[model samples]
Target: MNALETNGLSKEYTGNWGKRTKVSALNGLTIQVEHGQIYGFLGPNGAGKSTTIKLLLGLIAPTAGTGSLFGISIHDKRARERVGFLPEDPSFCAYLRADEFLDLCGKVLHMDREQRKKRIAETLQMVGLPDKATTRISQFSRGMLQRIGLAQALMNKPDLVVLDEPLNGLDPYGRKELKALLQVQKSQGKTVFFSSHILSDVQEMCDQVGILNRGQLVECGKLKEMLPVRNVRLKVSTMDMDTVNRLEPLVASMTREHHHWIIQLEGASRTDEVCAILRGHAQQSIEITRTTETLEEFFFRRIEENNLERGITRPEPIMAMAEA
Candidate 1:
């Protein structure tokens, strides 16, 4: 079953003065996440990533369309019960200690006292804050607070976890630790849906990715399929200036390094043709490797294409709020 699904989910905000000015925070965003998968929501700043999360959390109502969590309507309070959420900026009772905060969350979830105690201990350790269980939240560092927020989200042991900009306040070590925790959740058959600006982490951790631009989903699919081999690189030994000039049209680019020439073919299909052309040149050996566009590259390319399509010289930020 799909963990999350949206159909033309859109949100709009109107100016305080009048209805004449309107902003579309999210525009007809339709996407899905399957069970037990790590889905990454990627976009630049103010791209409606957080807006979508808020809508899913039922913090705001959508102006158009609908969404669901594990088949339950997002509008239904019960739907949120099965979902754990960590907002981009989370605020808690600063006076409460870490363990107290988690215990309070457990009580809110109606977990039994014994169960809450056991889960709290496990969660604190899982988030690398076992030693800080007695420390007040106000005394915690930004990274530590983020970890505590994550722990509370998992305290309920919900089937689906939604995190907004989860790596924002984390150090390198903390980031790596969180990534491993996410992987562990996946292993245990829990679905993970997160938004992040860190493309490298998304590229490494997500099985599926959706790229949002100007409140629209420009790309969504398996990470592997979304990033395809854009070109092929061939290393040849018998390549000289004459060979380079002759093969210039067939290849995207070429350069000589030390004893061999590095040629970039436009596509994989041209590999055989280029190899045949190089056969008569008496090359000792040839090494051909396909190069795929990275997630960062694909993201910018999509944004650029979208801008060009809309005749927009400079893209404006998408609205990130919904009208009451």
Candidate 2:
């Protein structure tokens, strides 16, 4: 059985007007995650990622459909006991020390004296906060708070760990440590469902990905399948428009400058065909080049498509996306 499953899951929020107005946060979304797999839930703002996570964790009720964890309904006590969650913003009592917070979590999980002590030690070390165990949460940085949150989530040693925006507000070193910790979880056979707007992180860590747009899942598949195939790109700088017109069919797309044509050819078949087509117009000089699309490119294209479909104006890239 899948570690987690959502069937026709949906959440609709009614406006104050009571005129039967509805906004579907999740619209008939269905997904399954196997044990020991790292699944990336990716999307831009307002894509229903948080809604899906909330529904799965039973923090909010689904308008239509059901979700199960470990073959049991999420609302069941058994299922809730086996799952862990860390929201995007993890806030707690600032007066409590990191260790104290984790102790509370263990106690809530019903761990006994020896069990709680041992688990807290191991979890603190795992999150690289063993030294900060006694430090007040108020003194901790945003990144440190996130680590403490992760440690608390792992206090019960859950089978499934769901983290929303795990890398948010983290520095390079902190992000690296978090990624390493996630790898350790994977090695331990724990299933991880992580949400992020950072495509590069998702590309690196996720085996499977699902992209949501405007409360609807626009794409879902294995990482390799979802990524654009690596292929050659040619920059055909020519002064002739007639030659560029002939080359359009052989290439995926082309951009025309005042006196040059930039053609992008994908895959070997198309590359060879494009070369041949360019050779036929020998009068026009053809510059054959090769380049592969990055995961960021694929992500942006998908986002642009979604934006265009909704007639939303595209804005400049977010700082994270641009840097990635």
Candidate 3:
């Protein structure tokens, strides 16, 4: 059975001023996360990413639809008892130590004294915060705090782990270590559901991904299935403005730096024709460079395509896993 499943889930909030604004934080969102899979949920601001997480966690009542964890209704306390969550911005009792905070979370999960102790120790070690267990929450660095947040989430060793921007405020090293921990968790047969705004992290960590925009999930599936076809980059050592102008419109875009021109083609479809065109007017020798599309390229391409389809403009593309 899937670890987490949602069918037409949605949430709407009512304002304090009695203004009738029906903001659908989640609009008929439907998704399913399988066991041991790291499902990456991608979206722009106000795209209902957190709302879905909150609904699945039973932190708030869903305005519409239903979801389940481990075949149990999300509204059931037993279902929540089997899952763990870490918010993007985690805050605990500032005066309490890391160990104490984790203890509190363990108690909330109804763990016995002996069970909580062993689980807390293991989780702290798993997240690389074992040595700093006694350190107060206020004294921890941003990276340290993030790690503790993860540790607390794993205190009960729940079957489904949902992390909202798990790498938020983490340093380069911390991010690496946390990613390694996530892999270990998956290897142990646990499901990981994480949302991120960094495409690279999602690409590297998630087995499957879903892209959301304007409260709608536009794409979903394995990364390999969604990867675009090969594309080539051309570097021509030419100073003639006429040759550059001639090749610019034939391809996607071109950049000129000093006497060298960098030309980018969308795919391998007509690259041979482009090279032949460049060769006809080359004032100097040119070099050909080839590279496949990375996860970021795939993400940007999807976002651009969605914008064109809906005729709605968006600002610069949001970076995955990087946004708070």
Candidate 4:
């Protein structure tokens, strides 16, 4: 069975007392995530990414539709028994020490004293805060606070981890460490589902991704399959000007790199013809590399295309996470 599933999940909020403006936060969103994969939920501002997450975690009831975690209905408390979550913005007991706070989290999961002790130690170390266990939560830096939030989430050794904007407020090194930690979690057969504005990190970490826009899922599939090979390149030893001239028509762009010639082609279909000219006819030794459309590029183009088809004239503010 899939680790997570949502079918036609929707959420709408009624207007405030004075106004009759109902807002559709999420609309007919459907997705399935398999076990042990890092699924990146992506979207532009006000796209309902957080709303969908809240629905999936049972923090709020969906206005319509159903969802399940490991075959258990999301509405059932048992569904959350082995699930861990880190909210986009989390507040904690500022006076409690890091260890103390994690101990409380473990207690909520019904772990015994010894169990809590073991996990508090383990998770602190897992999040690179082993030395700060005795430090007060009020004293930690922003990055440190995020680390502790993650530590609390993992205290239960959950089977599935759901994170909203997990990469928010981390420095370069912190982001690197957290990405590595998430990969380690997947290596342990735990499923990871996270939303982030860091497209590069999501591209690196997620095997599966779902792009949400305007409260609906615009795209969802295996990352590799979703990004097609868009460009082909060949680097080779110096070629005769005549041979290069013969190849000029088929190549999109040609340049010299150090002592070699580097040529880029528009599509994978040109690989054979380009190679045939370089290797078979020209007899030049060549190196071939295919590049795909990057997640960032795809994201912008896809969202823009979606907007255009719907007659939205303005470009979207893709990186503004606060409104999403």
lDDT of 1 by residue, 89-133 (tens): 888999999999999999999999999999999999999999998
Q: Scored by CA lDDT, what does every candidate get? A: 0.92, 0.84, 0.84, 0.91
Give the Cα error of residue 301 in candidate 3, in Å: 1.9
Worst 10 residues of 2 by lDDT: 283-292
Any idea what lDDT model 4 has? 0.91
Across residues 1-324, which tens digit of lDDT does each residue of candidate 4 receive? 999999999999889999999999998888999999999999987889889889989898999999999999999989988899999888889999999999899888899999999999999998889999999999998888899999998999999999998888888988999999999999999999999889999999999999988887878999998987899988988787777898899989999889888899997888888787777555658888989999999998898888777777765557765577
> Residue 300 CA error for candidate 3 (Å)?
1.7
Per-model C-alpha RMSD: 5.7, 7.7, 7.8, 4.0
TM-score of 4: 0.87
Ranking by TM-score: 4, 1, 2, 3
lDDT of 3 by residue, 55-133 (tens): 8988889988999999999999889776779997888799999889988998888899999889889999988877988
lDDT of 1 at 312: 59
- Candidate 3, after superposition: displacement of residue 99 in Å? 1.3
Clashes counted in candidate 1 amount to: 0
lDDT of 2 by residue, 135-221 (tens): 999999998998888988888888899999988888888788888888888899999999998888888888888888888887887
Alpha-carbon error at 137 in model 4, in Å? 1.6
Number of clashing pairs, model 3? 6
- Reference-based TM-score of each model: 0.83, 0.78, 0.78, 0.87
